[model samples]
Each structure stands twice: as C-alpha cells, then as structure tokens.
Target: MLAAYWRGEITLRKLRVLIQYLPEDSPARWQATDGRPFTIRDAMMWRALWSVATVAQQLAGKDKNAFENMPAYPWSKPLNQNTYGSFGDHTPEEVMDYLDSL
Candidate 1:
C-alpha cells in the first residue's frame, strides 16, 4: 500500500483514512490476507507502512518505497522485516509508539 502511495495509486489523505478504517466488520477485516482474519496488528502494520511512505516522500521529495522496518513482537526489538512478520497482536498505543520511535 505504501508502494501504491509512492506510485500515485492512493492519496495521502486516503491512506490516513484507511489506517483508521479497521472496524471488525469492515472489508479490511473481513477480507483478510492469507485467508486470516485482520487484527489490530494488521491495522498497525498498515498504519506504519502508509505513514512512513509519506514521510519518506516528503523527506526525499519523490516516490520511494522506504521499506522501513518496524518493530513487532516482544515489542522491544526491531524485526527488520517491517510488520509483515508480526503476529498482528499489538495494541494501538504500542504501534503508535513504535512508529513515533521511527
């Protein structure tokens, strides 16, 4: 999704809105990837991705994946694999702190 943003496939405003549309009944939850149910962790992962993508674009003044690594699990170490490796169980505050730390 961050790549989509960089590629002009989604607007920053839209991305920000998407990060919050994580209700349990929403498609973001119902249409979970890998046939798994979407959880807060997934929401957090996406929030970080879309956010960092915009940050990178602003810093670089151009489109780029950034591919920023986000910390997940144990919640104290950098996974170095973004949030994909996460079990998608982090709390909203935890995810926010991680992103702020970035």
Candidate 2:
C-alpha cells in the first residue's frame, strides 16, 4: 500500500486511514502510522505523516482544508495514551525507503 501510494496508485486520503506506523517494533514496518507495522490500524500514528496526508487531502478537496481534519481520530485518545502516547512525526518517503530496504 505504501509503495502503491508512492507510485500514485492510491490517494493520500486512503493512505491516511490505512496507516500511520508507530514505534517499538521488533521488526520495523514499511507502511507505519507511527510505528505499528506494515499495515496501519491506528487512528493516530505520526503527526508528521498526518500533516502530509491532511495537506494532500485538503489540496485535493473541493476547498483546501475541507478535509483538513482528514484522519482526525483520537490518535492517542486514551487507553494507550499513557503507554504509547502519540507518534507525531515521520514521512512517507522515509517509510517507503525503509520498506524498499526490507
């Protein structure tokens, strides 16, 4: 999916909902929200990635910022907030490179 996104197979909106890749993985993932895994299941991964996805969505929207709050789920809403917190940073390109490396 990450590779697909990079290759322009998928839009930023889909990518955002799909992943963020967290951290603390025994084996790093290529498609991470913050640091989750190859697949994104978390609402909140990295704010940086969020920022990128958000911007792309907004730009593609009828009006910029329309979907500004694209993946506005409680990233670090609660339960995991205490332990995992919010990832808040990372780039898709970096993740893509990582995936390629693997």
Candidate 3:
C-alpha cells in the first residue's frame, strides 16, 4: 500500500475498500500500543489514508468523491479524539526512514 502511494497509484476508493473489507479479526488491522485492537473510528492508518485521500480529491477538483456516499462502520463517527496521540507526525522523509527501520 505504501508502495502504491509513492507510485501515485493509490486511490480513495481503494483505500476505503481496504479498510472496509478487512475481516474483523484480521491481524492487518492496526493495534493500540498495548496490543489491543483499535476501534474502526480510531484506526490510525484509516485516518492517515483519509487525510491523504481528501488531499488528492481537493487537488483533482473532482465533483464526485470516493468517500462521499460510502457505507461506514457503526463506531466510525465522531472519532475517538486521538486516543493514539500524534506519534505519526513525521515528514515524508522521516516516515521513509522509520519505515526503513522496520
């Protein structure tokens, strides 16, 4: 997915599908620091993907957007208000470095 983002092939629709279609017990779902699962509303990767997707939509100036009419999870609204804090506040280069270390 990160590779797709860098290659400019990532789309909001795809990201939404990726998030929405994951099985409830899939290990790919993001986790909290203590290893608990994140509520869908508070999923960090979802928020980041949303942020990037919104930016893409604004840049393209499209009348129709991917997320505008999509179904949402029951707990998806009025988000958890940053329960994970801001640990992902790195610049693109910094993020690349962090990813490299993994």
Candidate 4:
C-alpha cells in the first residue's frame, strides 16, 4: 500500500482516512490541525513500521532463554530489542525520505 502511494497509484486520502498531501502553500495544508507538511499516509506508514518492529522485539524477548541457550555456530543469539530498536529511532520524516529514495 505504501509502495502504491509512492507510485502515484494511490492518493494519500485513498490509503488514509481523511488526510490529504497538498502543497506547502496550499490552503488545504493550512486547514489541518496537526500542522504537518505531509498527510496521515506518511504518519501511518511510520506508525505501522514502528509497531511491527516493537512486536518483533517482544516476540524475540519472549524466548530469550531458549535463544540464549541455542548452540549456533559463531555463538550469536536471536533477534532482540537491541537489533530492532534502531528501526524505531527513525522519525516519520526519515522513514518517508527512505521510502522516496527507493
């Protein structure tokens, strides 16, 4: 869905509930209460990615003992908060910038 938005296959309003991405100088941009230059679509993508990373961390932590005890070559543990936390460090703007680069 996010890719579709970037491809212009979907409008911001189509993917999101009520938000629209308009020009910075457009009247619609000023009408928003959030005062963000972009629309909810970008926010939603950031939130969704963050939520996924958090859930992944929780699942990894749930089996902490099992992962720690595993005898894998090179002696590395499974994924944990430390591995995924960096993903959450990115702001919505940074996430959108990355997506745009793709």
Backbone clashes for every candidate come to: 0, 13, 0, 0
lDDT for model 4 comes to 0.53
TM-score of each: 0.28, 0.21, 0.28, 0.28
For residues 1-102, what per-residue lDDT tens digits would candidate 4 score against the true structure?
668889999888787743434444454564543443544565566556655665676687643243333222222343342443444556767977998999
Task: State model 1's lDDT.
Answer: 0.61
Could you tell me the TM-score of candidate 4? 0.28
Which candidate ranks first by TM-score, i.e. highest? 4
Every candidate's CA RMSD: 19.4, 21.1, 19.8, 19.7
- lDDT tens digits, residue span 15-73, model 2: 87666543434244523444434323443455556667667766776324423444433
List per-prediction Cα lDDT, in the order shown: 0.61, 0.52, 0.57, 0.53
Best by lDDT: 1
Better structure of 1 and 2 per TM-score: 1
**Local accuracy of candidate 3 as per-residue lDDT tens digits, 1-102:** 656866879887787787778865465654522344556445656666766776787688742344563323324543333343333445567766887999
Model 1 agreement with the true structure over 1-102: per-residue lDDT tens digits: 668889999999988787676566465555444435556776687667767766877697653433443433223354354454443557667878998999
- Candidate 1, pairs of clashing residues: none
How many residue pairs of model 2 clash at the backbone?
13
Which scores higher on TM-score, 2 or 3?
A: 3
